[model samples]
Target: MDVSKDTPQAPATAAVPDDTPPEVSRRLRLITLVATFGGLLFGYDTGVINGALPYMTDDLGLTPVTEGMVTSSLLLGAALGAVTGGRLSDARGRRRTILTLAVLFFVGALGCTLAPTTAVMVVARFVLGLAVGGASVTVPVYLAEVSPAERRGALVTRNELMIVTGQLLAFTSNAIIAQVGGESGGVWRWMLVVATLPAVVLWFGMLVMPESPRWLASQSRFNDALEVLRQVRSRQRAEAELSEVSALAVKDEQEKLGGWQDIRSTPWVRRLMFVGFGIAVVQQITGVNTIMYYGTQILTDAGFAADSALTANIANGVISVLATFVGIWLLGRVKRRPMLMAGQAGTTVALLLIGVFSLVLPSGDGRAYAVLAMTVTFLAFQQGAISPVTWLMLSEIFPMRMRGFGMGVAAVVLWLTNFVIGLVFPSLVSGIGISSTFFLFVVAGVFSLTFVKLYVPETKGRTLESLEAELRARFS
Candidate 1:
């Protein structure tokens, strides 16, 4: 059920009740950094392709269809990776799963860097997709489980910040590499290789980090849960939080709630899954990836020369990172549902303008600048509102026992939506021209707004366990 803004409620605060020791505070910050390198990899690997693809096209002899294939293959692999990664984290543990994914990140990057054939490149990208998909699910879930209830939104959303930071890093790296090697061949390979360093850092970092206390508690290891919690939280608060989490963990195991059968059989789980799937689909249908994955091409179509388009594309990455900073601030001050509605509305208008600018303006600087303005405006709303909320809400809403699996399934839906959009966007522009293609996104934005207004629930300012109980009562 949607919570009304006027409803009586306590004031919002991100402060944990217990005072944190300086060492614990530093440890918490360090953990956030290390864990978010997974997010960094997620950003760099996905965003690097945006700049590298043009060069790769020439090097690999890609046609339009093959170009789409190369781009979409990683997304296709992500679709598979989402479910598999989620399940692995659920059965094993969050830290363990992330450590394994870091290795995948390394291997996948190396494979893509060295591939001599399009077939091999496609295969390597798919392998990288696995790491990307796994990181998306595991990193946020780990952060959510480890955070204080009051700070969960801010802490968990750090992954989203790192994601865009990685993207910016990719954009910056791509620009530098392109410029430095303007006369040389295979610069995209250098772009692809930058991702490997972070993968190595994430692997070494995860080796020293503590596992999720909630996951350990869910396994009936109460003592271990407290120990893990203490690594991030103050001793008194860690103990207090563990008591509440332990009670839920016991009830969860008693109920044995997990997987497809559990989700189908339980009323609230089914409803949450429905909501989760809708959230995932809503995010993708906005066509944000078109900008993230193919921003250079989008700018080129807007009229800039190829080299100029690559440099102009950096604006998109910069706005995404800055807007995410605003989003992290907003997540603390504003309610989530309204932020989502506002974002959708902003993006819809931006899309409408993009179509208008394309259809009415003649090919030249004016048209290009107008569309560029709209794309930047569109991403400000998207990264600030929609993307962060989508990921944070999915991380928040699932039952503790099945958080990994539930989010995995929703992420599958997200990635599949992303895959279809990535696969068809080139054809979409080819068949309909730029104006009509954006108009289609405008229509999608309308529906996405309606869905959120009526069905999406508020998840702000609550612990995951409390949120789950509230949802169970309402859905049941």
Candidate 2:
């Protein structure tokens, strides 16, 4: 295997196809789906908190500020977990790392459900955050490494699809449980407990799946890497991919791997990291989480009654899932940068309207409905365009040897940014009012759009190795 720019690389592996031997593709899809349970848990925990909060606050005796803290604690934990998880996955293997995270998710969810006070809840939520953050970084990278290039975008993005679907499930469950369990002393506990099911599923799921072949090869376990690849690929295809990947791994080893030094010394890698950071920031600044975490609140502020807001929030979840489907569809066909810019542009316009609607309409049903409409529209673009691109780009941009570390660091920035926004959104809304809060988002969206236009690279239609080479050439 001559590992050069001209080497004949194996075509990226496909998910087991429907028409192909059912034995192979069927097992592959099942493995992919099971591994992605991390994603479903990620969606459920984060989205469940949105509706569960009202009941939680009353039960736990929470103030507005404390309420924000409860919501953001997981995000804060995710920030640390994202970076640590990425590095751990890189140093360990993706399979082991995800399995560890599955345990964390189970423990954290159990803790949250059983928490007796706000303090306990926050700590427990932080633990959950760690799992979510880690999952955000690890799952996509694992999927990308395992998937064939032609189906890579779709397969990798299935995690995102699961993420939103998890959120929808959270919303639906919260609504149902709240409606049915109303007046129960701790109905919110039931909401939190639902997360445990997926966590258990994730742990068991990863037990049967192979580690990413790329990660294994990166660790110099060539035989083990080949065995894993052979399970998923035709023997010929497996050998070819192993040859190419092994060559890259050897080259990376020759260069010496790991740490802040690689990032500082390698200008191209550093530049890509900057772009990754910007993408992560851009995704958050669209105020999408504002909707995810506090959608009911936003609807209430706009004009809906408490019950109506909870119900209306479901619409947000529905649109998010649907938009993600569109996003996943677009991922294969569209260039990453353009899709991002379009998402930013659409979100920016939507945020501006949200501000205007809040300011112009008198406080009543009209104002509430108008703001709700804009939020939905904002999500249509933000979830459809910005989010999927951000995750896909982060997963795709890093070199194989440093994929976990690089993406983890980027996700740390993302989760921290989310934490900051989630922490302050209530205070900001209370102090400045909805108009100003949205205006701030509008400004952030502009900066995000500019960053994408100026720095982000197009990543579609190329192998990860080729993309790395192209980025190095352009940035170097």
- Give the clashing pairs for model 1: none
**TM-score for each predicted model, relative to the true structure:** 0.97, 0.95
lDDT of 1 by residue, 234-284 (tens): 878888788878888988898889798898889889988989998999999
Which lDDT values do the candidates have, in the order given?
A: 0.90, 0.87
Candidate 2 achieves a global lDDT of 0.87
**Least accurate stretch of 10 residues (summed lDDT) in model 2?**
1-10
Worst 10 residues of 1 by lDDT: 5-14
